[model samples]
Target: MEKRRVVITGMGTVNPLGHNTADSWQAVREGVCGIAPITQYDSSAQKVHLAAEVKDWDPTVYIDKREVRHMARYTQFAMASAKEAMADSGLDLSAENLERCAVIVSSGIGGISTTESEQTRCLQRGFDKASPFYIPTSIANMAAGQIAIAFGFKGMCTCPVTACAGGSNAVGDAFRHIRDGYADMALCGGAEAAVTPLSIGGFTSMRALHVGDDPSRASIPFDGERDGFVMGEGAGILLLEEYEHAVARGAKIYAEVVGYGATCDAYHITAPAPGGEGGARAMAQAIQDAGITADQVDYVNAHGTSTPLNDSGETAAIKTVFGDHAYKMAVSSTKSMTGHMLGAAGAVEAIFTALALKDGYLPATINYKTPDPACDLDYVPNEGRSADIHYALSNSLGFGGHNACVLLKKWEG
Candidate 1:
């Protein structure tokens, strides 16, 4: 059987940079850094002092107060972004078959804040002091569940908890569902709100977080002085529909979901494989799946997490996959501004890639002063620029050796 074509109709995001897609994209294009001193909790006693937190968020804007009380921060972010995406798509759920719609939102660590708070309450008082909504709100799958419930989507509703790659994996899975004719349309993305003391302390113990207090230099990916990643929290969602189905409804298309590739290094649990061998394979597989040569790809939204291993390794992977063209293509890591959104990073970067294709612009890697010898790509340093990009790739590499890539093409029609 022939596979169906898939196209993205809408996108939404609530991240450290902004609360909506328009604001976030504009901040990205302008190279605004969102990292700053940790404001969610007092970090005076903590070794890691900075993070990229959603600024001045009010859940009541998207969800009712009573309902918001029962939801975790991650779920709230997911629902808020999903609401924007659904509205942007102009998808009349009442007119379509509910069973034909799907939701695949994911999170790496869901409700860690809730768990920490409830655990403290239990220990300080009693186990029975825990809220009845504890189990429902803290699970990683709740984001996908809540989105489906709110939108009345009675289709496949699931979440991918593949660490940092969870969001990209969710988008890829949803794309396959539509392309394989199992679903007609879907909402997919990832969310993460693990900025609690416990989450930050754990990552700090592993030496995975940047210890710098300077907001501008906290997430300087591919820069020589970079030491570690800055934890970020938020959600990003995209509305995808079959091409013919979307055209029939006169929906505005953002980009074509042309290819998806997923791979595992099977080499390590925390660190990436040597030379980013697994990431190279994932990119090669995505290019092959798209039926395009490596040279046709114009831009790459790299998974440059600012860690020594990841940046150098991902650079090697790009060179391996694209050879000399890797130097010519515009490559940048928006993480330089938004920090690392953990599982949500992939989905958010995917949305940025789609916007880049639609708008013919390439975001920059901000605060990049000294380039690493190993990572010598263009990086679109310091400032964004206009480009006639036809194809763009978004990459997400995660712990446990997982790597996922999604390819997007300009929507000419």
Candidate 2:
């Protein structure tokens, strides 16, 4: 089968460091840490106190009071990002074209804040105190559904829920939809707002969060002293269309979606396979799909979650896939600044990768003072670097042993 070409034309994001795509990218390029002492809720009693929360976000400005009340923070973020992405796409959909545009956004855990609030009402007040909108706000697919409804996109709408890989999977699925002639374009990405009391406590009980209070050192991916990931909340959205269609419409292409690969460890729920064998397979599959050799790949936006296991496993996987070239490639984990946005992580990182390819700049993996020998790679450590990249790979590995990779190539028309 001949492969259908796809290109990214628009991007939007609301991250912990900033509320928009440009601001977030600038903060990441500057190696600024967004993690800080928890300010949304009282964290004095919790074992972990730091997170990269979306600071100064007043959803009321973007969404009305009554409308915001019916949704959770994750949904709010998704809606805002979708609005921006559609606007950026410059797609003036007519009545006929409206049915050809689609939306597919995902989340690892959605409406966690709503769940916490409803449970509090049930336990503290009474069952009757629970709001009627609790169920609509708490479901996982509502993020995608609400976005579709808001924009009146009636095409293929889906939400992939593979833990941290959810975002990348959703984007990849959207690409497939257009490639298969199911839709002309898609507004695809992911959103996450899981930093609630129950979420923090659950992850803390599992020893998945960094106990360090210092924002600079809290979520240091590829660092020897890295304790664990810092929870974060945000959303990322991208507008993707068939390459020829975008070109015909005079859309500004950012990068081409060359390949997508996904695999499951089938070994452990939370722990990755030893030596990152599963991750290596995923990366190899993506390279094969792109019909390109590993040497052609210039950079990798790593899924380095700051967890010791993931950092080491990802490094091993890259070595297996690229061999000697792995040492020369500029790899970085923007999570070092954005924290771990869970389902939204992949989308934001993919945006960074596309921007890197577009601007000839690689963002840094900040706070790399203490290096880990086990995770030895270039890592674009501490400072951004300028490099003309032709091809780039973005990786996303999730809980439940899910691994996904996407390959992007510089646009040349």
Candidate 3:
């Protein structure tokens, strides 16, 4: 069987840092901290009050009012990003084969806010008072479904829910689908808006969120003072097209999707394995799949989720995978600025990785005043720097010990 080449033609995101990919990348490169005091919902009673939210976002501009009423915040974000990505790609749906296109968007904890609203209504005003669109709005796969419906796509519509890894897994699966001749193109990524009262309370109760008062210090990944991750919400979508197809249509290629690797720890529910073996294997597999040496990888957009365990574990995993070269490679976590966007983190960071390859700019790990000995890596601390980047890797390690990675190659042509 002949393997087809897959490349990233366009990307879009509505993140805490910015409303679009260009704006988000600018903020990231500038080392701007998007974490702020929660204003979306009252957090006076909450232990963790700071969260990174999609500020100044008006879904009505991107989605119709009547249609937006049925969609959850996550779906709305997905729709906004899908529209941006499609416009960016300029891949004429009318000219190309619609049956060969697919949508594979994902959300980790879909519509938690919607679920809370309906449940509250059911309790206060009886179950009959709950909205009829509750189930459709809150379901995990609805993001992909809605995108398919909106765009008239007739191929492999899917949503892979691997917790926080959902977005990265979605991208990887789309790449494989195109590479394996299942689809010619795919609109794939993840969207999430889980920063609700219930989610914040649940994470606080589990001691999974940081209790810091300062927004700048709330999400300091790789820093010793880091307590836990700060909650975030948004979406990131990518337009992936076959290489020949992209070239044939004169689409601008951001980067080439060269390799992908996914693994499961099968250990604890929320904790990683003993020595970060699973993450290491995922990185190794991605490198092997890319057919490149460890030294060829110049940068890593880490799944460094501000939490102490994740930072140390990811650092260990990097060292294990890259050996001595790991010390030389630049590693950074944009979660330092954007906070942890749960399911959407993977796709957002993957875009950053591709951008890093495109522009040779490694984003900073903000608020790294005090570094831990455990995470003794060149985390590209505090400021963005330019480097010769040929291959960049992005990681998405989730709560259920799911580790997913994708390798991006700088498009030389």
**Top lDDT prediction, candidate number:** 1
With a 3 Å backbone cut-off (N, CA, C), the pairs that clash in candidate 2 are none
Candidate 1 — worst ten consecutive residues by lDDT sum?
Answer: 209-218
Rank the models by lDDT, top first.
Answer: 1, 3, 2
Q: What residue runs in model 1 are displaced by over 4 Å at the alpha carbon?
A: none
**Residues 352-398 of candidate 1: C-alpha lDDT, one tens digit per residue:** 99999999999999999997899898999999999999999999999
Give the C-alpha miss distance for residue 90 in model 1, angstroms.
Answer: 0.6
Q: Give candidate 1's TM-score.
A: 0.99
Sort by TM-score, best first: what order? 1, 3, 2
**Each prediction's whole-model lDDT (CA):** 0.95, 0.90, 0.92
Residues 1-413, candidate 2, lDDT per residue (tens digit)? 55679899999888898888888888877888898989889999999999999999999877778899888899999988888887888877763377888888989999988888889879988988888889889898998999888888998788899999988888878877888788888999999998888999999998889987888889899999998999998999999998888988899999999888899999998999999988899899889988999999999999999999999999999999999999888999999998899999998888889999998999999989897899889998899989999999999999999998989999876
Any idea what lDDT model 2 has? 0.90
Models 1 onward score TM values of: 0.99, 0.98, 0.99
Q: Please list the Cα RMSD from the true structure of every candidate, rounded to 1 decimal place.
A: 0.6, 1.2, 0.8
Evaluated against the true structure, the overall lDDT of model 3 is 0.92
lDDT for residue 163 in candidate 1, whole number 0-100: 97
